[model samples]
Target: MQRPAFDPTAEEVARRVLADIRKHGDKAVQKYTKEFNGINLPPAKFAVPREERLAASASMDLLFKRTASEIFARVVRFGKASMRKDWSMATPKGGVLGEKFTPLARVGAYIPGGAAPLASTALMSVALAKIAGVPEIVACTPCDKKGQVNPYLLHALEVAGATEVYRIGGIQAIGAMAYGTAHIGKVQKIVGPGGPYVTAAKKLVYGDVDLDMVAGPSEIAVLADETAVPAHIAADLISQLEHGTGHEKALFVTPYMSLANKVLAEMERQIASLSRCESITKAAASGALFVVTDNLDTGMEVINRFAPEHFEIMTKEPRRWLQKVKNAGAVFVGAWTPESAGDFVAGPSHVLPTGGTAAFFSGLTVDSFRKRSSVIAFTRADLIETLPLIEEMGRVEGLDGHARAARIRFENPS
Candidate 1:
């Protein structure tokens, strides 16, 4: 009825590629890498050499280093503050019950390299894994025809603490990361964003490896009132369109038709000068939505139904209306805040859920790279007191073995 709830073409292709990789392993990965990226890389040269990572880091200028350092500080600070610690409480029976956070032993971060090299995404995704203390952080990005990744992206991956780097992208990268290959070992989890094909591949490989969310093409929505500036709203709407994928979406919902007309005029005036105007124009024409609601409250309801990845509140007293938001990956409050700020320097990871998935999924965070295990230490008193409850529940659930195990422990308390 709804095209199987995902892109049929994307899933069909991804299923074939993933099954190939699951069976053929490295050969299948190489085949798709050549077909998609147009580069034939042998398994021997699949990895980015350590020396290359160093060279990319050294090539960066002082200004770039300083900027990266500042951004990294913010990301690390937020990660540290948000990370949960091992905490416990004394139970009534003098037993210890708590949760211990354990970082995944290995995780893969997929960086998009097709449209534009997402250097910021390297920090947004991989740096958080580093903060979570993941022992082995693997990064995979597509290489150009010359078999080289963007220096900035490579450098950022190194700064973010990726232990292993691969020159592969698309379904192949997800396959290699999810299913172990001779070239790249399997990772316990896969994180980050990509295009439609990549997004579909991630969904297909869910049980094989843990995933962050359904993060695909960029999306943004703005809720505005009479007080908002047309120029700012137009610029913000166009920002998500320039992401190169035709799947990118932008929405502007406001109470004033006059503002809607003005924003559209501004977009027409501003888009001509952008470097990626050709793709942006095509994407905007097909994906952009401009709605004039009856009031600000109605405008909020429209954008919430859209469930955008980046939601902007540009109305008067933006913070006061923030409480009304029900679905959004991230919110940019007030006029001075732009989506680009969150894309680059903001403390939170920009790898957010897209394509209306914000209704169910959340953006990535430091804890996405870790596992939480609840601890239970039962004293004799606790076991004895809870034993009856366990036995009764087990019997009701048709599991006498569970009841016997606890009863046996007490029965043979030698």
Candidate 2:
């Protein structure tokens, strides 16, 4: 499949808007929010009130609320289990060496609500932050023309422990969080997957705030065999394609040309029933492909090179093929495991690296919500043992002061 061109225009627009928001404060945020999302929110009203969040939670159906609770429990349990713990090891010379993990003070999550409300994302992003003990979790999403955000999304955010929720989206929401406006305070880091515009805005503000990854539109790849169900493969492919970005990609790879043809036919039949059929059709035409490799081994090579956001292995032995994959945001093991399972109910956060960034970056986890600090407690013996090494490096770098500072401690014999 052809890699979509990174939007050059998006960067230009984001840069201008971020600068305007940085310099002009809330006024600039409101202007762009109205222009792009049609949400007419004032500075004070940018953040949804706590009463509204509570009401959203209350209004949800009892059965649906119970289902959401079950999913959230799994998400939180996984976060706690996966979180890295602080530990120390004794150094060679009676010194202490270790790492300490601490939760971030404040963070922002961008939930896409333009084409869909994405209630699942509320738990996917903010729930992990909550589990990581982030004191203030701020959420941003686009509101309707009347400035009303999705009630379901608001309810999910509330349940997931969002301390603040804002009715804003697009580059404006990113800009507001990255560079603090009068009302929305700047966050230490920003996370969650978004459309092309949000992705570009996050990139422009990299120095202004830390970001989870260069996450954008969704993409998927499937390494399947003749034994794989054509209907299952087709439905999984269309899932990522319906994310409303025409840039989304869904690659179907198989050694058997017959199986590939069947999956393609199934995609056509299944797409008409989807609400985002127009967007899915546009994505499939431009971004989808089927590669017939020489064998499954060669097919695995093609998959790793593509480095898709979500990868499914539907062969005789999915586990065996899973060992061969190198660059996917997440791997679904069998026909029973679909990408949607990971997005909605799986223990891990759905916010993942996209656009082949999985080659270097990993998906969001509890660790993403915390910062690590290297801990070093040096003994006198440790300082003396490593002093010569430090002196040699300092001498080579021509930093005499660095060496002298250490040498002076030993020079006086105290």
Candidate 3:
């Protein structure tokens, strides 16, 4: 299917799912899972035993296990270093006010188990949560038709330090994790990437629990010039297009028509031999666009407007252009740095904002897993100093109780 342009209507649907889940928890979850995923495992399929989780990892090929572990180690290291300490500040009013950052006590990390199991996502989601100091991290992925979570995903989850792993997917898994079913417990927040239904569920459950951005189909935009290599541009475009068969858009912009056409031709030639050509074709049909600009600045302006999820700058001064880039989930500098580098082993979180949301939303990071509480310390001296102003402000706001409280504190000087 042509990846539909970023859909606000999908958010509406997600809101409905959230309401339905609240009204009828498991029943709604099961109904949606059965209708959408074509699976009916009931709540029994939710939990993946500790033994099974270990077995899943053990079953992996030695090399795969080694490589995944190494990657996990790097991610863990990054997570630890990314941890933020508590902070405070002294106010001019002699009052102390500041904020302390604490990891949520419990968190839910959703890993999409689509046709291609996202073992990498397991690593990203769980490792980040672990580093944030979450005591209980529950993970959920949908089971395949044969009723098993992909063993690789289970292994990744195990390595990433998931306290609880469930073989559930789609809106139901979300509902279960958010609402606490007979089998699954509620979580403080849910994080991951999935199809529209999953996005919808996250939207639906936002107030009940924290959520990441409402992600859309994957996208990559390349800013290339005559000096840039066509093959490199083609490869990068294909790399992103190969992410899925549906509407994953790839754009190549250049100052000259010749280079743009050359890159477009290169894409046609290179795409034919790719394993995911058919998928890429569908994605390209909706996702791909050729943007020709009179100059590099014009291209940069257009790119900033798109604010792609993945942006590659194939220019003479790639490093300089990095500063010009104001909106992007992740920026791939130069031809050598492809989006896939960031997708797998790059230190930054791959769970990024999509659908022009890079304008405001940020990619997943340690901050996403933590919450902040403002701390205010008012000494007797401070309270007495600010009392009149506080009382006047409260009175003007029509809060008699607030004004009285402030008045009492100053009047008694206790």
Q: What is the C-alpha lDDT of each candidate?
A: 0.91, 0.90, 0.81
lDDT of 3 by residue, 3-66 (tens): 3434567667666666686678777777777776777767666689999988988789998899
Q: What would the TM-scores of all predictions be?
A: 0.97, 0.97, 0.92
For residues 129-148, what per-residue lDDT tens digits would candidate 1 score against the true structure?
A: 99999999999999998889
- Writing each residue's lDDT as its tens digit, candidate 2 over 224-258 gives 99889999999999999998878888898999999
Best by lDDT: 1
Superior by TM-score: candidate 2 or candidate 3: 2
Which run of 10 residues does model 3 get worst, by summed lDDT?
1-10
Arranged by TM-score, best first: 2, 1, 3
TM-score of 1: 0.97
What C-alpha lDDT, on a 0 to 100 scale, does residue 324 get in candidate 1? Answer: 94
Task: State how far residue 116 of model 2 sits from its true place (Å).
Answer: 0.8
Which residue pairs show collisions in model 1? none
Runs of candidate 1 with Cα error greater than 4 angstroms are 1-5, 412-414
> Which runs in model 2 stand beyond 4 Å of their true positions?
2-5
